[model samples]
Target: MIARIWHGRTRVDDFERYSDFLIERAIPDYKNTEGFIKLVFLRKKTEKEAHFTLITFWKDIDAIKKFAGEDYEKAKYYEEDRKFLLEFEENVEHYDVFAEEYA
Candidate 1:
């Protein structure tokens, strides 16, 4: 499995709204892609901004390329994201999952 990690930040006031958008839109959008395994969405609010990290699991690099296009390292953004994010990061990091388990 491959784990793709992306990070973003928005104003503190937009935290809940951003989270809602992910639940309502982004999650569903990713689910439709082939080889989608699951998503681990994370967030934190500081004095100035709300940070979000999206870790999406896929079957392999090909599966990621399907969603991310041939340049899989580039970060993917949605239209609605413009309303929330402070800046767009250039790339995402992918890791080969060696081991994972849930208790």
Candidate 2:
């Protein structure tokens, strides 16, 4: 398995709006993509900004490539994101899922 991690930030006041954007827009797009097993969105708020991290699980690199296209490493962004995010991150991180646990 593989995990794709993306990080973004927005003004503290826009946290709810940003979360809505993720749930309403991003999640649906991800769900329709090939090889997307699941996605977990994490958030942290500070006085200045709210940070978000999307941990997306895929079956393998091929699955990710299918979802993200040939240049999969190039981070993709949605137009709706511009409304809430303070800055567009230049890169996203990916990790190998070496272990797991379910409850």
Candidate 3:
């Protein structure tokens, strides 16, 4: 398995709206792609910013390529993100999953 991670931030006040966009738009888009195993979104809020990290599991690199294309390390963005993001991250990180445990 492969695990892909992406991070972004929004103004603290816009946090809930950004979260809703991910649930209503981003998650569903991921579900429609081949080899998409699972995804988890984590959030942290402070007085100034709301940070988000998206962790996605896939069958392999090919699976990620289906979503990210030839430059698979590049981060993917939705049109709506431009309005909320404090800055755009150009790339994402990926790792080979060595083991797993479920609670």
Candidate 4:
């Protein structure tokens, strides 16, 4: 399995809106992607901002390419993101999943 991780942050005031966008829009798009396996969405809030992390599992590199294009390490974004995100992060991280368990 291949794991792709993306992280972003929004000001505390925009947190809820951004979160809603992720759930209502981003997640569904991921579900429709070919070879997409699972998603782990995480959030952390501070007095100033909220951090969001999206970890997506894929069957292989090609699977990620279907979503990320030829530059698989680069981050993907929607036009909606600019309204909430603090800055544009240019890249994402990927890892080779050697082990996992679901219960």
Write down the RMSD of all candidates, one decimal each. Answer: 0.6, 1.0, 0.6, 0.8
The candidate scoring highest on lDDT is 1
Model 3, which residues run further than 4 Å from truth? none
Off by over 4 Å in 2: none
lDDT of 4: 0.94
Write the residue-wise lDDT of candidate 3 on 6-79 in tens digits.
99999999999999999999999899999999999999999889999999999999999999898999999989
Sorted by lDDT, highest first, which candidate order results?
A: 1, 3, 4, 2
Q: Is candidate 2 or candidate 3 better by lDDT?
A: 3
List the candidates' TM-scores in order: 0.97, 0.93, 0.98, 0.96
Q: Give residue 24's error in model 2 in angstroms.
A: 0.4
Tens digit per residue, CA lDDT, model 1, 1-103: 9999999999999999999999999998789999999999999999989999999999999999989899999999999999999999999999999999889
Residue 15, model 2: lDDT of 92
Candidate 3, residue 24: the lDDT equals: 98
lDDT (CA) for every model shown? 0.96, 0.89, 0.96, 0.94
The ten-residue window of minimal lDDT in model 3 covers 61-70
Model 4 reaches what TM-score against the true structure?
0.96
Give the CA lDDT, 0 to 100, for residue 81 in model 1. Answer: 96
